[model samples]
Target: MQLHDSMIKEIEKSKDKIIENRRLIHQYPEVGWTEIKTAALVARELESLGFKVSKGDVVISSKARMGVPNQYILDQHYAETLALGYSEAELQPFKDGFTGVVGEMKFGEGPTIALRFDMDAIGLEESLSTGRGPVDKGFVSQIKGQMHGCGHDGHTAIGLGVAESIAKVRHQLNKGSIKLIFQPAEEGVRGAKSMVEAGVLQGVDYVLACHIMANEPFGKLICGANGFMATAKMDVRFKGKAAHAGATPNEGNHAILAACSAVLNLHAIPRHSAGETRINVGTIVAGTDRNVIPDEARLKIETRGANTAINAYVKDYAYQVIKHAGLMHQVETEIEVVGEAVGGKSDEQLIDIIGSVAKRLNVFDEIVASDDHAGGSEDFTYMMSAVQAQGGKAAFFMVGASPDGTGGIGHHTSNFDFKEDALVESIKLFTGIVLSLL
Candidate 1:
């Protein structure tokens, strides 16, 4: 069945409201897991739409804070972490605020369909350039050093618009249930797994999510992409005796040398010809003094590929590199797997559904069916895995939000931004998906 013209027209009428929400969210950007303010706004909006909203753990509530050593002292020590370069400070807040909201609209008895929207922003500052026009004329993030450079502002607004529009068609959706999930902490790739564990898809029969594409031009929507890369984030540490470098060099096992060797070998991991693979050592810290032998060294590494096998292969190789590097340097080592995401493939059946709906709505030209291997990973992989395990089909679509001919900046970049019109189209596309499924 085609999306009713009346429904499309109604969505068109709400475009202004959608833009307003986008701007409001953009102004008060919140980072992953620390989305308390964003959550409050989302919950309030959902409640206003007459949907039953549950807060604090039922759907989206703060997780218990980690019992780190000297919690109170650590909190005071990292008070300035909201600053751009002080990301480690932001981590604790994210851990504490990492929660999600699930809004459900019931229709007649039918298969349950779920729609997810990530609500967390990245830690990059928005560009203040006047080139993108007036929408960004005075758009500066109120929170210092935090901004929605990743277009999640647009995504959250689109989700709300879809939620509202779908509610308007609740009478016609009597055949099935549509669930709206506002997930938090996507930037660090940590939120979706928790939501999945909380049974967000307990009765879910199908799932769909959309992300704004920065490189694509406005007015276009990408229905199917090859898939996202499977990725793992790891922390590696080396321990050694600390001794004065000038007076007792032989007394310390040099942890810095071990860590450096591991970093170099990590890049030597072979890539598979079957799909893309990547390894990067993003951070390294060691040593307390220049005149002393380093007592400890730490490294943050990430591995990714288009599929699970390659991803696993690289991760295993990474572990070996760290182990041998420590052995070679005579420094004890520890490796911790901090985060992971399985690669995802869009189902052809669902891709076709999105394409057809876009066509009927006269937005088909904006939809492209192509495969992309993004090295970046998403926790949404967990949701996809959970749903697929239950024999449910899933698709993650990409919506273009970049102005024509301007790639803007890549995600996580300080200059990352997008066009507003794409928000309206995304809402309509998602709303149409709910209607079709019902």
Candidate 2:
């Protein structure tokens, strides 16, 4: 209890700094794989606190990364970050879009614990309404079409706070090591797999991660997350010969027709009796001119299920439909998988630890073990799986962010924002959990 109280004091002292950092990150939002500046900031803060820091390809495997932007896009982000006054030395490690940071500390030989934090913003314009949180607070996103619609900015701040608090109380901890994983590109569920492949969870004995839920009431904490659906994001393209629609329509193979057919058939995929299932064709693009038969078409699609096997069942059936759709239209079909994640359940041991700590803090008004329904996909499942594979226990927890105890704005919307005070509670909870384990 003495050690926990000490950690709480450290977190309380840094409350103002944590809120400032969250607002600062909210101002200059960056999207997945393009978070060069964000990664640098996290790395610098960890270094200042005396943690061994690693960045770039060393923290994330280049070959294993999926849905990465092309070189041109990555170069533009690098240039933009360089112009923002970050030294070439600080920005060089993340030059080619490999952006993530890992801060490590060694104590002796006990349990190795890791905490994961994601750093990326959603692509959305911010609302300029006067009463909106960001607008009223004067920290609205500066970049157009990029905003911290999700609470990752707050998560990053909490992670840094935990690092600072841990450094201050290292002597009171058990003989173990701590790792702070600042990940990128989690919005598309694309980053965690790469980090896991690069050996992030190699020797981990326990791993814990938390997300800020905008809908839940503030001071409410969920000990573990469940019903995470496994999912896959894919890009489908069709190629055909073009010709004048009015003159030689028969000579042209219609790629647009194939894409349309594929969309219909993809949705027609039967649901698995095993559990829930979902499929959506989010975007479709085809044709240059209306007078010409379109020669190319592209689609952005995704599939989800209650678990990995069920997700694969739907994905495989969708593939068959895509192939047949192309054949029906005499067009060539191409498919690329960009992102994927498997469903996972939190370990009961970790859940109990978090629950006990939350009770000790006496801050949370409510504590739940897990969600009732299957929630959306999270790449963190990959990290959880990796640790569990090596006999380590893992759990994904949730902290409420609703300011007025009413569900705030929903995530991924332009008006999305959360209670600033929630940041302090989150830091305290995370810090307490880490100290208890160490």
Candidate 3:
């Protein structure tokens, strides 16, 4: 399972193309289910590399997809991709939010190894201010209100590089198959479930995924992550009768009042003694005029915990508060579960393999079994849990993307940027992992 020199050379040769694709994806950032262009590029590249590519229903189960944008937004992004010079045929498979691709290359048979890379960007405007590398390099997001605030751009590029490297060394591989999964809508912990439900992990013997973290130094690498919180993202709406505030205040069921009550009480939900828990109402919208009682209100909320039971406890509490708040205010309430992730841990076996591979590569300056996870939620947990349920091993790790040791800028913000060289290191590690396993 030693990585051959040819594989390393192929990865080395792809450095320029890898960076080029990263910048290309970063500049035309798409969010969530609107990743037509990004998926198209990945599909084309994998197809060119002689891998069988699957898309649309084969790659994602439509009914399992969450937090999808409305048809109008989907069509708008479809048209935007077309305007970006991608042909309708090139973007066809990614239409209607069935975004992402799975590229498979089999060499006889052994164990099926899958590598996942997320492809969507956050809904944040790019910073035009100084010190943003994308701004200075003229690759800042061209799309308004959409930017690759995380290192998904780098991850996507690393996936492609690994694909090329693996393709080059296919002759040396005797058995097993490799699957490169380019996922979308990871920001809200969406996308993975649909693909998993579509049977992506059905035959996956080992599933490996990674994230580029700005908080870790450039040469640092974690073999696998820990403390992935179980989480649920929900949207709530309140409907009430509108009336003149002064003249008919009693007739109006205050939707905003119910929303405010729910917000305040949601935050006040007693923290579980079992583990860390979190609740947030990230956005709220209601009302039209000053004198008119607000008729409707909508809230985007999320709850997280160290495990599924704890998260369910928080969700249940939040739900009761929301329901009672609406009833107390005389407004009808509607709650929708949009996204969810269950807690998972990386397999110790895979972690050991990854740690060994990292040490043999002689690239990473720091290697650890696990790093500071801070109980974040990742949709990859869905796939990891799924694969493990089928008696397979799965691991999701983190690669340091900060070169200057400042850990780069905070993610999900306008100023987010990271050292691009992390792309090569990630590709090397991932490609090496594949060679070691397959």
Candidate 4:
């Protein structure tokens, strides 16, 4: 009881900082690998908190990265972020699109516990309507076409909050070292493998990560998810000859039609008899004007399945669709696997630990082990599997936050928003887990 009180008190002391960080991140949402602004702030805060910070190529291996933005886009975003109030010195560590931070506190001879926090937003416009989103409060995403639709802004805030909370109770942490891992590009499930390949959890005994609002109402906690599907994100581009549409329709091989065909056929992919399968060509861009045939078309696509084999099956078949669709249209097709993650189940023991800790905190109306299927895939599974392979335990918990007044808003949408107080709830959950382990 005394220990729990101490941790809770520490978290309460810094709760304001948590909310402030959340709002700040919400105001300047960065997408995927272009999280320079957010990462710089994270690095600065962690350093101020006295944790040893790692950045740039130090945290992620270069060759292992997938689905990263092209060099030009990254450079432009970095400059824009710098203009927004980040120092070149602070951004230096992650210069050239290598963004993400890992902060570590080492205790003499205890277990190493790692907490992963993804810090990237999805590409979507945020609602400016009063009460429906942050517009009324002036804390809405300032970046156009990018918003923290998945609650990662809140996740990043929780990471910083946990750092401050635990820093207050450092003396009690005599048993283990804590690592706060801030990952990027989790939207496309693109970041974790790079961190894993860079040896982020190399010697960790326990790894825990969480997300906000998996449809659970406020005050409830889903201890962790199982059945997290394996997934692959692919970038497909088709090139063809362009000509005036009306002047010489046959002279042009329209890449847009080829892309449309691919989209239709990709959806027509046979569902595996073994389990579930999913695919979506989320965005397609082709044609400069209506008068001319589009010579180039690009698509953002993703596939998911119950397990690796199933995901692989869909991925292979997707490539064939792209190939055949282009061949059928006489266009040159190019596709690259930009990101991928293998599915896995959470360790029951780790889930048990989270449940017991949550129970002790008394922060929840109901604490339940997640029987929920993680309807989507997460790159964190890569980190979890890596740790478990070395005999470590891991759990990815879910924190609930049902937005007030508005109906349930699904994630990855413009209207997606959550209760601000959920930041404190997340901090408490993480602190609870940290105390249990250390």
Candidate 5:
């Protein structure tokens, strides 16, 4: 189905306004759960567009006593709370807090459709040089040490623009509901699960999401793509006896050595013949003193695959390695599962709808299918799982944002940037999806 010519023209007319919102959001970047300023701005804009909004708070509570023995108790309590399903409101009293907001546009009511956009930015310094186009135009991020290097600013702006445009035509929309979700903490891949548990997708018939691609050139958009990788995040800790390196070199169990062994072994996880798999030890900390055999060591590791079975196998093998390394080193070991994201496959039916809209809008020279999956993961898997669990279908698409006229630097990099024109194109795509699905 095609959008009315008037609606297309209206979207075109608001292109400048949408770009302005994108620039404003880019100027003041907020990271993860600490998105107060960003959330406030988004809520204000969403309210102005005549959408009812809901705000959610982080759920961390309980205080740590300042002392020796009590410190361990406090730390354990904190970790346990995180492990359990704590409400977002329960975490608000903590030093660093998280917040979530949802906007809704209710129309004639058929199948409920939802569109999600992440609102958090990464911690990266933006380039001050004029070499990045539009910098001289004052469209650069103003915040220091924090910038929308991940294109989330554009995503949020596009979501808001689509919400506004859709609200204007609510009377014409057939029987269905549309929800705009501006989720937080997507950087750490921690937001969507909690939101899903909170019933964010409850009563929703279909769900859609998109990430702006800094690789696709201007006027080009991708519809069907299996892009995000399945991911498993694990925290491994090894406990042993601490002793002086010189005086009691042989007295300690060498937890640090055990940690090192596990890290290396994890990286050596064999490749899967079925699909692409990767393992990495992102962070490791052990030994407090140069001359001491540390009693405890911690390693943050992640594994990814193109599909679910490989992801599961990689994770199991990694756990076995960690377990055996601790046993061999004679140190107590504990593995905590931090996060997991399953791979995503674009729905062929949804892809067809997107292609049809693109053809009708003449937005792309060719609507090619994409099979490249990024090693990065998204918590949207939680929502996708919930939808499929309830006999519903979902898919996420990539909108081109490459500003170099070709794919630019990878996402989350300090120099990551995208073509500004892609923002309006994304808005159009989202609008079309809502119309067709509803």
Candidate 6:
């Protein structure tokens, strides 16, 4: 699909503005459902540009929300962004404290197309060392402990840029609808399904979403990285009695001990011979003082499998381990599923469309015509699966951009970041595909 020369010029004009928007978002990184400032900015911009926009819980199913922060936390974040400049009216839709945006426009009657961009940051303390951190670049996140280590800020900016390019040519667009989905809580794989539950995929015909530099170099692009792994995120809590350690150690039941046991047993689970699988206890909290036995312990554990059956196998084993660990320590335990996603595959037909479009753009160092699915998981799978369930075609791509030449740093860590230039390529690539489809 060749983007008309005029259409190419339209996208070319938005390049600088796109990079600027990316930096603005990078400076204020918000995590998951707490994206008040981000969502508001997205909604306001799309609304001003003349698209019908939907915001907040209306885009999510409350009953399906999982692992949400407590109300106090949600309210605190909401207040913070409100103070940053968003008005109460702009925030009214977020009354019950959820955040996301969907901007849709039907330009004459073609197939309905959706672009998904995640709007969330990770819980990692960004680097501050001289010349080695985002802070040194002046666009550092103002919030102390949060960071946009994942290139999502770039993703959001690109989505907005793509929308603008598409809008400029609306007069020529015929026979199709376009939807821009600025999603939240993607870090934990928790937002997409709710939107799916909210009927966001109804009548949709094509879907495409991308993630930045999983390892590919700054100029390389993976037309389709097969698909990501199936995954399940769980929160476990163990309850026990607390007592002074020196006075009577036996009188106290240690919940931390139970958590430790579970963490070890979780890692000890046999690997799946069928395919790649992974289990990790990412965070653990328990105990106040070293002299006292902790009464409560909590764990943020996750499991991943290359496919549905393998993921199910690992999830079942993980649960058994959690249950038995509690029994071994004689403590009551509770478990809650925070999020889940089944493994997925890109539609080959759609992949070819994207590859052809990307080639004509004359950008990207390498275009991976095809590749194997990932060992990690992504909630975008939920949206893609939903679209496919209704006979629609879907594709997920990898936008490679690495500054140090090591493929952007580790995704969920403190040093993670990709070249902002990826945003430019993304805006061009995504818009090109939309033009071809429309």
Q: Which one wins on TM-score?
A: 2
How high is the CA lDDT of each candidate model?
Answer: 0.76, 0.90, 0.90, 0.86, 0.75, 0.86
All candidates: TM-score: 0.89, 0.98, 0.97, 0.92, 0.87, 0.93
lDDT tens digits by residue: candidate 4, 1-438: 134676677777777788888889999898888898889888888999889999888889888788888899988887877786777788877777789799999866878999999999998988887875477777888888998998999999999998887777776556679999999988888888999999888999999998888356888788878889999989899999999999898999999999999999999999999989999999998889989989999999999999889999999999999999999999999998888999877888889988888787787887879755787888899999999999999888887787762327688888888887778878888887787777
| TM-score leaderboard ranking | 2, 3, 6, 4, 1, 5
> If both were scored by lDDT, which would come out higher, candidate 4 or candidate 5?
4
List model 6 lDDT by residue over 1-438, tens digit each. Answer: 347777777777777888788888888888888888888889988998889999888888898777688989988887876786778999878655478799999987669999999999988888766654365677887788999988899889988988898778777776789999999899888989888998888999999899887456888888886748999999999999999899998998889999999999999999989899999999998988999989899999999999878999999998899888898888889999998888889999989988999899888878887778566788999988999999999999998888676674678777776777788788889988998887
lDDT tens per residue, model 3, 1-438? 687566667777778999999999999898899888889889999999999999877889998999999999999889877896888888888888999799999998799999999999998888899766887788989888999998898889989998998888888788999999999889889899999999888999999899888877888899989899999999999999999999999988899999999999999999999999999999999999999999999999999999889999999999999999999999999999899999989999999999999898888899999754646899999999999998999998998887467775577878888888888888888988888887
Per-residue lDDT for 1-438 in model 5, tens only? Answer: 347778888988998888888888888787665565566667777888888877654321112110112345334434444454554344333223335678887777478888888888888888877667538667777767888988899888888889878988887866778888888767767567767777778887788888888866666667765757788877789998988899988888999989988988888889999988989898898888899988999998888887777889999999999999999889999987666777777677877888888787777665765556555678777677777678777877777777887775678777777877887777777887778777
Error of 3 at 363 (Å): 0.4
Pairwise lDDT winner, candidates 1 and 4: 4
Clashing pairs in 4: none
Better candidate by lDDT, 5 or 6: 6
- For candidate 1, the lDDT comes to 0.76
Query: Can you write out model 2's per-residue Cα lDDT over 143-227, one digit (the tens) per residue?
Result: 9889999999999998988888888877766588999999999998999999998888899998989989888888788899988
- Prediction-by-prediction clash tally: 8, 0, 0, 0, 14, 5
CA RMSD of each candidate after superposition: 4.7, 1.1, 1.3, 2.5, 6.2, 2.2
Check candidate 2 and list the clashing pairs: none
Q: Give every collision pair in model 6.
A: 109-175, 109-176, 110-175, 110-176, 219-365
State the lDDT at 184 in candidate 5. Answer: 74
**Stretch of 10 with least lDDT, candidate 1:** 60-69
Where in model 3 is the C-alpha error above 4 Å?
Answer: none
Q: Which scores better on TM-score, 3 or 4?
A: 3
Over 322-406, each residue of candidate 1 has an lDDT whose tens digit, in order, gives: 9999999889999876667788877888889888888877864556864576557777777887898899988888877776546
